[model samples]
Target: MNMMVPPPSHSSLYYCFQILLALVLFSLQMLTHQLEASSSKVEVLPGFEGPLPFQLETGYVGLGETDDDMQVFYYFIKSENDPKKDPLMLWLTGGPGCSSFSGLVFQIGPVEFEIKEYNGSVPSLVLRPQSWTKLCSIIFVDLPLGTGFSYAKNLTAHRSDWKLVHHTHQFLRKWLIDHPEFLSNEFYFGADSYSGIPVPAIVQEISNGNEEGLQPSINLQGYLLGNPITTRREKNDQIPYAHGMGLISDELYKSLQKNCKEEYIDVDSRNELCLRDLEYFDECLSGINHFYILDSYCESDSPLWRRSLTHELKKSSSSHLTDTVPELSCRIYSSYLGRKWINNERVRKALHIREGTIGKWVRCYKTDFEYEISDSVEFHANLSKKGYRSLIYSGDHDILVPFMSTQAWIRALNYSIVDDWRLWFANGQVGGYTRTYSNRMTFATVKGSGHMAPEYTPEQCFSMFTKWISNLPL
Candidate 1:
């Protein structure tokens, strides 16, 4: 054997080369994974004239098992002021089914629809001067499932608030894992409307996860809510709110208080007097736009509002009866423009949306989306005890979720008032009133604004937001 081992065999050399090649390929693959973890790039949106004037990245974060088709879609806009150092807000719009794009264009995002004309083509985009992106990086997400560009492999994956909270918690963890660079940035959970019900729960989950030593911790510092629905009892405040605004006579309001016992929601079936008062109350508000009593009621044909018909039946029917009231339907035209713009084939490609994934894009989805957990008032109380910073604002003119109701809940929190109610100045005038609580919670109202504060009072909202987030008085 020692005499002539045939020196070395070509077969052995070939085997060694194969092993080396495999190792090299595996190493390259690992490098690729790392690169993809932070794979955000500048976007070139279709409706916009040139390349996106600001940095925007669109991506999907998978939920549940890899094989499970639950995925959440998101639009991340890097902070124009300082992406690296600025806070990161996870902004969830109301409607529970409203697309994140609604927030993007209508509320806080950098661009808005330039509704100059509607020729059955995609609507042009224009820069929003008061975009929240100027102060903090924003992650606008289509939550739950079946919203915006987000879709689940199975329709059954559509979730209610209970499951939605867990999924959203998982989404935040996974998103941070992929974009680790933002893990250290100050984080806040911002939501409005019905999203108010889930944002607190989601924050609580994140807090619990961090406590359990979860991977990729979130640097959650606080949260933001505007015109939020904090409890099911929110409807109970309508009569009082109506009376305060002088929409109803004192006698009618007193009759309601005596008959309804301040419980408009879930009225006792046996209370005939209460029912009669409610009937009269309904008649009085029939023609008023609950969203903004000052603004004319605008009828919308969008599927979102159509689905919401049941919820708005009382208001709609009332509005219909009052033919004398003025009609200003600008919001309807805006909704039509957005729907057309998003559903375009070219626009889909520009946004990197997968074809056949979503059916139609509406500003807000219908109630077909289930919600298992309804109330999150306790979650808010728990979060308040944790010493987290909070900012809750409402549109003073909004009758939908009246500012008075919001004030009621804040008072219920039992936190001692740190700063007594006072006018918050913006643009050298009184923008709204604000009160600070001992637990770092601040409640402010945007004067002359509606349910969607940012949309109605962008400049004042921006000023208040910038000041509050900067730890300055609003």
Candidate 2:
């Protein structure tokens, strides 16, 4: 059958032009950068007292032919149990812009900021008893440029979700090329939150590279996502989540469902009923903390804080540092302290952070980021069909990425249940629930935890990771 094709509209032509230009610019960036994969061993940091017990290395993997073109910074922590045999993970922190430092110091990392009153000095560091470093060597990266210690000579290079995955995959190859000693170790790609969009895609990139006979073949075993953003529909799932959690009344919930059709994120301006119902929904959720329901919502955790807080505001938040976390979510306070600690000149020098690289490091920044991928279910399906082991978990208390949504996507995979849903334990108590699927994928929930499960329920998350990584049924 022959069909007449419509001429490309002006908007479509412009979009195509934009994509072509981006490709040219990106190729130029590749040629211009002076790629250097450098590493430095650190014995001590400013906050932590005395010599560090675990081995920590900080380095930069250049992404271009010239300096400042793009330098991706990273912190490598060798496995405490057995670096030689333990799984090696290239962990990306979510935010699409958040530093992997969150994964290191806040979530699964060895040392955490001692959450207490900040005496205006460098915040103290305390060792986490359930650090994931015990089971695996982790590479915590400042990915996608302009994130943490990473920087780009041109800010334009810092745009796009596609670019983020591309650069990260490149960084991994360069890193493994430099550290070939760990190439034979079981490798995993892990991340949380917004990384759901990129981590799976990164896995696909790796698989493609390996198939193409790339050097230093990564012993790719599997991957993990903690409270991941699997699909955009999850945001829409929040309305049902709210209603079920008793945040909204049945009458209002019914009204929303009837009028808005559960499309809350983008209600039509012309649809008066839908708009009114959405406003009611907003009113119900206005003061509530979306990250974790249990956490007390503070001024810093407010929407205004997200919109207005600049570099200075982020670096100097001592008001919340008074009297053992009064008026502050412990998570936000710890994050504030982390910002303070990392910005310290001495701390940067100790970690061997490149001078003149970053001006201020925000814990999470989405302003410069460009979102292209709306759903990662395709990547998940593709990876699962290849028999890649996966651990997809959610924090039960997190409304940001609810457990229901995680389960929804997992169910969409159409993999048969290998292990029916059951409780997983830690410390002789229920930690979370778990279920295994036909494709070697396991899904679990961290009870009473938030968006970043490990940040709140470290012990349970650790237990989950240890068991799953060791091939034990959890």
Candidate 3:
């Protein structure tokens, strides 16, 4: 028996609605894919004259239980030389508050600010010849939220030390899930300055996660650090380092040793003699540039000086050079140019930065972040026992966290010296000195460089990094 059918007009209407539903679903899927792609896409940057010559992907990795609020921003640059086979390095810039862009544009990234002069417009970017991107793939990250373009929905998400380590470990695991292509690649954790307090723990966390059969295992290899602050107070060898650099007299040094009992930090407030010695010591070191002894201390007008003073103000409610004001140096002026360029709306849009997420893009974001972990020296020692390769480098001229202090901590590890101290050369000139230990650890110095070695000696740093990463002698 044949069933009664609807009229032709009704049948046509039903078919049309079905077709429209299908089309809508397809469009929604496409939109979802496009959004995902856009999150990791960077087509053009404002400062650059033309399209980006190399691959630069900017994105955010969601963190925490829900993976919705805490977003960590990152700039991933594929290796210009060999993206497929080159080792992948997670580069973290120190400050516990410094934006990773400082390392990206100023140190090892593909481009640098062309600050021949500042005309109030966006500072142009020039190709850096010695960028590390030529050798290995790098992910420059703005971590711990509240940094650069990274932010969290809740203000309490701002983390410190161990919490940072945990968050970073989770970030890497999720980041690899997003970009699975590099999951099997040789992975490394690297940082500079205050990162010394957290990097080792981060590495240890990764090692433990991998050992515990965590999802999307990372091919953990080793780590890199430059002028690291291994211990909170002990690593700050300012006075002794000053004496070695001839910034102080032997008499004053002896007085500090005798009165302060060789402990310069956290001295007894009741000891008037110790306080007097430290006062004299402070006076002697007042005019010196702690970051780079050789470089002239650019006065308050300098952006770098202002930034440093801002950090000092945040930490201690005062600054040593508050009364002194002088002319801006060219380097400091160039550094200031980066701030102007990054804060530009056009540049931010081109880089795919989220609107209203960050108010200002400063080199270092000053905040009251109390770190959970006091020190990470034990983490380094534990990592050493794990047989992972490690590189600890210092800028010899840096007084803030001097090479002598780094050496003293390494000595505390009691690792046998595999190779004694020797000069490492680049372009037929003695670039620096290096030493190797039995525990797969190497310590080196960049001669005439400041706290930020690559920023000061890009070519030499590139040479040193390329060789070190390749397991070759520097």
Question: Highest TM-score among the candidates is held by which one?
Answer: 3
- lDDT for model 1, please: 0.79
TM-score of each prediction: 0.87, 0.87, 0.88
Candidate 2 per-residue C-alpha lDDT over 339-364 given as tens digits, one digit per residue, 9 for 90 to 100: 78988899999998767767776655
- Report lDDT (Cα) of residue 303, candidate 1: 12
Candidate 1 — which residues are off by over 4 angstroms? 1-42, 301-329
Worst 10 residues of 3 by lDDT: 301-310
Q: Give lDDT tens digits, candidate 1, residues 368-470.
A: 5565556777888898889899999999888778899899888988989989999998889899999999989999999999888998899999999999888
lDDT for each candidate structure:
0.79, 0.82, 0.79
What's the candidate order when arranged by decreasing TM-score?
3, 2, 1
Candidate number of the best lDDT: 2
lDDT measured at residue 362 in model 2 versus the true structure, 0 to 100:
65
By lDDT, rank the candidates, best first: 2, 3, 1
**TM-score, predicted candidate 1 vs. hidden true structure:** 0.87
Which residue pairs collide, candidate 1?
286-318
Candidates 2 and 3, the one with greater TM-score: 3
